[model samples]
Target: MIRDALLFQLGYNATLVTLGAMLLGMAAGVGGTFLFLRKRALVSDAISHATLPGVGLAFMVMVAFGGDGRNLIGLLGGAAVSAALGLLGVAWLASRTRLAEDAAIGAVLSVFFGFGVVLLTMIQTMSAGQQAGLEGFLLGSTAGMLRSDAMIIAGAAALTLGLVLALRRPLTLAAFDPGFAASTGLNVARTDLAMMGLVLAVTVVGLKIVGLILIVALLIIPPVTARFWTERTDHVVVLSGVFGGGAAYLGAAFSAALPDLPTGPIIVLVGFAIFAVSLLLAPQRGVLSAVLRHRMFQRRVHLRQGLLALAQGQPIYEPLTLRLLRREGLALPDGVATPAGRARAGKALLDETRWQLVRQDPSFEAAAAHYDGLTPIETVLTVDQLDEIDQRLPQPHEVSRP
Candidate 1:
């Protein structure tokens, strides 16, 4: 099944559609990084929802002009224009009005999508709209995608990819620190608009593959997932593209094999699965790794504290000390610290001094003046005494050189 899906044995159409989906995913991933960085992720959602009316209106206009109502170029052109207008409206509402960015985005998204639904309804009632197949734009159906449609999507993807590579340095500067970028004579606003244009291109191309509704997932999930694995901007962008492309390819292949599944949702699900795995299993940043590191730190602290007690000649509970020594691998089966154990304990003591957790050359005589009863130095030291000891300790820089 895998071989058939990948090798075009399932059919040429399936192969073409899968390739188109991959291109769409790659472009969306790269463009989405800027959106993610700008904290404007929801703007893409708004833009996507806003495109629906354009699609419906385009279909209606085509029918009015006595042209094919399902013309891909005309519908996509409408989508791009409406999406851009939606973004402008969001920006205007945010800047000119008191509405917050989120509120503006939400308002534009809902109003545009509602208007689109109305237009779709109006089209459905028209005589020529019966065969429009416009509903595919709403939830996506790759079955209707032709070779020409795939070619157009490929072209848009190529353009988006090229723009991203050409503008990477400027885009990175703008995304991270627009104020600094502006100080350096970069037109932050123009750079932002260019990035948004790339996003619009990808969104427009992705509509036929994942539909507008799920296309935002292509822009969001992969980039976020890639973030878990790296800190560098370039690495994240590259990984995000790889993850997005892989998800699209696998999802399209699976949908092709099943013939009953929608490719858009499947692609989203596949991307989400990758995100889930990364969240749980990725190094350093993953949940499991973080938990393990926390546990290891706790155990090391316990062992170090036990070693400190031994170094200071303070009486420690034998079982606790033994346990710490065993865990640190510094004790034999007899539960006694060997020479190696003593060396490790000395290292722990040095670390404690470095961390300022313990004082060097603590004066027991000065500390005991505050306590009445005859208690061990560690036990008798009051909080005030400990504070004084901390103050009297040689500073890290003042300590004698080795």
Candidate 2:
């Protein structure tokens, strides 16, 4: 059962559909990274919604011409045209009007989608429309996907991926800093339009498998999830593609196994599950990891401060300070610095002094080195030197004062 559901059994139709969905996911993931980075994620939503009227209109036109209304190429071509128009409209609104990008996106999304609904209703009244299966474009119906339809999706995915790789550097620069990219003689606007074209292609290809309503989730969720695991743009893009492909594969397999299930929503749910897990558990940026890092930094700060107080012959047994000192092996039970503790305290104060001096004179490379964890801990300040340094150094509370 598992093997058959997973396409390992070589069921021709099942394998083709699964492959198509996976490729669509990968292309959306790669293209969506650019949109995500440019802070234009909602533009994808508008584009996807705007494609609906095109799909409905194409079907009606084909039927009126006495041709098969379900022609995949015709439907996809219409979707591409309308999606491009919608994207351009949003851009134009943002640039030419008082409306911000978000308001433009929202306005375009609702207007296009509402018009699509009107077109869909009109189509349903046509004599041949009942057999058109146009509603599948709204909610998705992967079970009806033909081998040729799958091929179209695969070709689009390959084209999108190729273009992204060929233009990676320019696109990266444009997304991060358009002014700098333009200053370097790159056509930032052209690069941005090319990216939107890729986004349109992905949205059109995805219409058959994931539907218009949910396709934006495929584009947005994977990239957002990938961000939790990396800081580098390149890594985030690669991981987003992997995550998107994984979700598509699993969703298709599960949907195949359960004949009543819909592929698009299932895929989105799986992607959301992955995002939730990453948001809470990823080591570098997850909520749990951030909390733990914050606690560790606080403890280190407290220990260093307590050690400095001990070196100054000041009391170290304040509840929080004393606990932190004991934890770091810097204070004996008698609330005094051990010999080793005294040595570490002297080093800490010296390190603090160098940090302060570096702050005052930013060109002090040697002082910067100590804070980088490159300086050996053998460096120490005598009690008198520490005392003199303390008199000039700003206290922790005073450092934050105006």
Candidate 3:
């Protein structure tokens, strides 16, 4: 069944739902990058939560007007309006008052969500709203999704993605350096509003697929996962989109294959799965790679210290140090140094003495600062510098005649 869904053989509705989810994920990832960069990730949470009131209000309005309150378009439009208002409220509280942005976000998120819950409760009491299935907006449900709804989702997602791509430059600049952008005649505040607007659009459109609560995961997780793989902003954005799209595609397919599964939660879980893998395995910043690098650094420190001890004729007491020496053929079982060990020891001692001399000399101050005990002296000093330092070494005394 999973294979059939992945192959798009689960019928037209399943295919459209999966494809729409793909576009939504991609738009969320691309749009969320700026939010993450700006350290405003919580704003997405606020915006998403704030959509609930809109959904409820839209439902109530439709019911009051004698129409079924379950129209996807009307519900999404209502969500957009509510999210935009919420975004504006956060901005106003942050900029116009003494409250921190996070505080504003928290207040808005709680208030709007609470109000939405009350609305939902009220909705349940009404005969028309009882079976409205408006509860699906909390997480998400694709069961019996209409073809027109799927088309709407897919087209709106594509439009969002296109706009995000078109404005990537200004958004990227504002995120990284609003001060500099302002100096260059860009309106930082306006750019920020534009960014929030895009986020609002994504939050509203995503209310059906990932829903209000889980959409935050769709917005934030992919960019975070992408951050583990690269340092460049452009690469991070592109990789984030790819990861988001893939996770959503697979997640939607999984939900379709197993009809019991909820679409929103399944999608969020899949995204988290991708994030976990990236956290553990990406070479540049992954946990496993970091551990390996630490071990390599520790090995270098141990070897350097052990070589210094050998050069100074110090007793090797540490078992690991002795084992390391033996493994490198530098010393014997009894801790006796070999001929090769002696040669290496002499070079190590000379290098240590040279470092001491350089440190003691005021002229070599800049060069001496690079010494980390593990860094080779040759790498720090030029040929002439080494020659000058070597010339200063103690000359062998002439044997006195008896």
**Model 1 Cα lDDT, one tens digit per residue, 1-402:** 766986668777778888888888888888888789788888899999999999998888887899987889999999999999999999899999999999999999999999999998778777552567777787677886788888888788878887887898999999899999999999999998898888888998989888889999999998899999999999988999899989988888888787678888999999999999999999979999999988877665666666676566555566755687876677655655667777866666654443343333444545435332212345555677567555745676877878
Model 3: residues with Cα > 4 Å off, grouped in runs: 128-130, 347-372, 375-402
Return the TM-score for each candidate structure: 0.84, 0.87, 0.89
lDDT of 3 at 55: 95
Highest TM-score scorer: 3
Model 2, position 43, has a per-residue lDDT of 89
Model 3 collision count: 0
Model 3 lDDT tens row, 314-368: 9888888888888999999998888888888888888888998899999999999
After TM-score superposition, the amount by which residue 271's alpha carbon in candidate 1 deviates from its true location, in angstroms, is: 0.5
Clashes of 1: 0
Q: After superposition, how far is residue 280 of candidate 3 from its true place, in Å?
A: 1.3
Candidate 2: tens digits of C-alpha lDDT, residues 1-402: 657877546477777777778888888888898889988888899999999888888887887898988899999998888888899999999999999999999999999999999998877776542566788898777776788988888888878878886788988999999999999999988998898888888889999888899999999999999999999999989999999988888787777667578888988998999999999999999999999988977776777778778878888656877887777787887789988899987877766665565545555455345563324323543466445545766567756645
Query: Looking at model 2, which ten-residue stretch has the lowest summed lDDT?
Result: 372-381
lDDT (C-alpha, whole model) for all candidates: 0.82, 0.83, 0.91
